[model samples]
Target: MVNRYLPFFQGVVLNQATPTHHPIPGNGNVAVNFDDEPPLLEELDIDTGLIWRKAVSILHPLRSVDPSLHAEADLSGPALILLSLAFFQLLAGKLHFGIVLGWATAASVFLYFISSMLLSPGRGGRGDLSLYRCASLLGYSIMSMTIFSAVSLFLPRGGGLIFAVGMGFVLWSTRVCSRLLVACSGHGDGHRGIVAYPCFLVFMLFSLLVIF
Candidate 1:
């Protein structure tokens, strides 16, 4: 009897000593057993100086078109453009129109971002890419145009040189934007062309403003 009772107590002790596994909560009520997962990629912190550098790079095609370098650029280009527009407006004594146009410009930039994400194929579908990156690429692509717009305010309007410069910038920006999209989002030429259409419209609109 004592031996039998000893065996029973030992079995109880062993059962009690065994660790219990708890299910880890996942998406909803689902349980997952993964011990560890890879960490998510971190976003890049962009500043004004970085924005300027990215703008310069977009303007020059010979420069590296690596999308990773600009993975963290933000929507700061619209703000810069608005600031320059405001300065020009103030200079021309049309502060009211400047303020209105500034607001409109911000809205237009936001719309452009949304449209690009929606229209650009293969964006946010593969490998750590996101809509923020799309916005960053577009923003940086427009940097040179923004600067050119500001500078054009100082130059005499209606000159052949100004028209030529505006057209050149438009063409350059369109090509740069398409290439940047391809490099950053892995979009093919067709998709890049579709996405670059907005860039053309944007630069063309700016050109019109500069001209008339």
Candidate 2:
């Protein structure tokens, strides 16, 4: 019966571990799985020196083509951008925190499929951008929309100006995201517009959220 539930036990069992790491065990060769141990503070890679520089760089689409802009795979910068977005939306009397995170995740997965799977090998864009990298890139890319959301709080409702500004920020995000995809994934500049389209749509969705 324990054999039938062995997988469940394995899932929860902590690795008290063996005698090699402790005094010699009286029991038969002590068996343990150390996978569940909480990481120590020293063991954690608490390095966050890059978050500020990377966040600042993300605000500039011109730097998007520079591979160095995305040298690290990080979610901290994106988390900050997302939190700011939620804050702005909250100020605008629309609490869309859940929708923002969900859509960001969906958009990341969608772009990952596009860049990592849909592009033919001949097109030179396949399997180069991992889902984690795509998520990180898009998370940073959304900073433009985050800014737009903040600006939108002061703008009048039902005006072309808001729409125009939203479109501009959407373009900004598209430029940064698409260029990063090309630069980081080694895709040719020729396919940049193709990548930009989906990115444009992703940003446009966020912009529309800002508009309404």
Candidate 3:
């Protein structure tokens, strides 16, 4: 009976693990005992800072080559741009237009988040989500809504200036968030850094073009 339920226990342990770490390869014979103390940090070199560096290395290029990364990032980029654009429209005293634009931006962001969750390597146990990830998403969502509200309230005045500030925040926030996700996955290496950075630069440039 005990042997039959061993795998079940293992699954629970795995589910609770950090995204950056995986089972010690070839250690399957180990039983999952809940009463057992959590694994030691040193056992896996599970440093958040180290993991972040590794994530940048792994994701930078793979993301660059992966068509899905391009598609997903593009979706996120446009949503961010629209969100900023809506603020400008509202600031210009176009309330109805701004609301419509804001709504559209919101929808796009939802899709972007969904796609990112699905397509990014860490949505499941192998690339599991974490508190930090949830917080990052929450912050972005709040910023998006706040910008819209501000535009709605103060029109034909501070739209461009506020929009620019918002865009800067979006750019830096997305870059850092992506890096954190990579680090948490514990694959610290520059393998993916090349692609990710370039693609991000392109995205930034595009946004700048829109701004200017």
Which 10 consecutive residues of model 3 have the lowest summed lDDT?
Answer: 65-74
List runs of model 3 lying over 4 Å from the truth: 1-89, 93-125, 129-171, 189-212
Task: Residues 1-212, candidate 1: write the lDDT tens digits.
Answer: 34665897978888899756445556564545455543332223436576666666676645646566676646665455556655664564545456435534553566356455644554542333455555556556655566566667777776888788888878776777666666555555566666667668766775666556
Candidates 1 and 2: which is better by TM-score? 2
**Quick one: best lDDT, which candidate?**
2
> lDDT (CA) for every model shown?
0.61, 0.81, 0.41
Candidate 3 residue lDDT tens string, 1-212: 33565888877777788464345658964544545666676455444443333224323322422212211111233334345555564564544445444444443354345435543566332343343343333233233333444544443334577456646544543454344435444334342353244324433432332333
Regions more than 4 Å wrong, model 1: 1-49, 61-64, 92-134
Clashes of each: 0, 0, 19
Flag the better candidate by lDDT, 2 or 3. 2
Measured on C-alpha atoms, candidate 3 has an lDDT of 0.41
lDDT of 2 by residue, 84-181 (tens): 99889999999899999999999999999888654556666554588899999999889899999989988999999999889989989999888788
Best-to-worst TM-score order: 2, 1, 3
Looking at model 3, residue 13 earns an lDDT score of 74
Winner on TM-score between 2 and 3 is 2
Measured with C-alpha atoms, the lDDT of residue 65 in candidate 1 is: 63
